[model samples]
Target: MEHILHVTLPEATARAGKEIDQLTVIMDMQGLGLKHLSPSWLSLVGEAVTVIESNYPEVLGACFVINAPPLFSRLYSLVKPLLSKATQEKVQVLDSNYPETLLQHCDAESLPAVYGGSLIDPDGDPSCPSRICWAGPVPDSQINQSKQPHAPPPVIRVALSRSASAQSLGSSEQFSVVEVARGGQRDIPVGFLPVGVELSWCVVVFAKSFLSCL
Candidate 1:
């Protein structure tokens, strides 16, 4: 899962890493491969991996990237050189031929029905007997509870400038949907300024190319 940027990663510590390592061992008993579908994998940004490696090093035993489209290969090549040898060895990229690979790691019954598994995909055909197979981390109480709709957050608009190698914006600027080509980077000023004012912000990615902070 892509982390909400505002939710800070836990500070790196030997104890925390040990706890995560223990959890990884438990997940190994039943398998915990991440089955990502195509197109969505394009949103797998470098910062996400950095967070994982920095705070929870060696937590993932394997990563099953399934059903990646042709363009995924180009993206992979662009990033392959940047990944460490160990990290590269842990990733298993699969194309349409993913069922067999998935079965090798995950049991058919535990797999999602949309991927030819016994369990129904939550977003699968509604006519199926058990379409809503998973409800995720939301508890049943919260799911069944009735709540009033909350007001939406206000949107901020900003002007952007294009330059070679990197894109930039003023500290006061806020923007969305600025596409920086593969291998390019951008710099935007952010965060608290009054020495120790305890500032916080959140980044929500509404689209593959869109990012907004509040």
Candidate 2:
């Protein structure tokens, strides 16, 4: 329910947009909603809804505006007309029974501890950490200082065969002979190969390498 917005574009802008769309679809399917629990609704700027509505309008299952002060009502009225009918319908203003309302839609195990859910007890449990929601922009200095270059993910190389046999040099017995029945395939485990590592080895040429298999 915590709506923590990070106002920074990722390095790969193209992929980030695609990922945002994917996350929107996923959240919509999961019946997740945004909980605006801020004391003041000033943080609910135009940019917040603009990105979501522009990219994946259907992603938002619901929007629960809770703990909004009386001042927010005027602002809300102004913005209500701006939003589409479908989006406006999804917004629920719950002045009281905030926890109970969220419980109706979400399981206790899934809800946060502060909202009467059993996710974790931050005080009693050492592993569980909790914090109050902060709706603000991260300082540019902090962002630049905390930034670190990301490394590419590891590549998993798989060699498939209908039937294959192998025997070590100077060994009498054949080792790692895997066979697959018709309309089926097998995954042969190759020992740990780290990232940026190239594996090259000679294998007995029992069958020609097929592009389809590769």
Candidate 3:
């Protein structure tokens, strides 16, 4: 949130000749969990919305939310009342097949390859890690406990492996980063080796999560 208000807004402003300009926002809600619906979380969203509407009204050109689950609609319902009519009109919930829709507003060269764009990271990463800041997992200790415990909040839950990162163990192996949609799973094909031959794989769930499986 701080990054969006401080860094993103400033960059967009400068790009628009130092005046506030319309900006497009694309959010990947791939790993949204039940914790996101808590009152504490919702209030933080309310706070951000308040700041944006009060200070930067009509700054959004369009806001695209890709890879969003059905539960996201419920979350939006709670937030709908907070948004002005113009801002509400700008919000769009899209499926994983958002690349084609987004291409209508942006050129393929202007976007990263992960979003069906031609621009790929120099390190061969399609997700373009250098251009986008991927979020690391948050720790339980850092989580804010709800202060208004008496107030009831709607319940929701989801758990699905959306993607995986693989490390090449052999010189002949080629690998690249890819994003999987919610409720979608990616299969990494492993070739059959002779009885005398050995094969190895290094799968990283996420760098910050420190989870891996062979």
TM for every model, in the order presented, reads 0.40, 0.40, 0.57
By TM-score, how accurate is candidate 1? Answer: 0.40
Give the worst 10-residue stretch by lDDT in candidate 2: 21-30
**What are the Cα lDDT values of the candidates?**
0.49, 0.51, 0.71
Candidate 1: segments with Cα more than 4 A from true spot = 1-44, 121-214
lDDT of 2 at 202: 29
lDDT of 1: 0.49
- What are the per-residue Cα lDDT tens digits for candidate 3 across 139-185? 68888776765544322212222355233222223443445564466
Superior candidate under TM-score, 1 versus 3: 3
C-alpha RMSD (angstroms) for model 3: 23.0
Best by TM-score: 3
**Model 1 poorest 10 in a row by lDDT:** 21-30
Q: Against the true structure, whose lDDT is highest?
A: 3
Instruction: Name model 3 segments beyond 4 Å from true.
Output: 1-20, 138-214
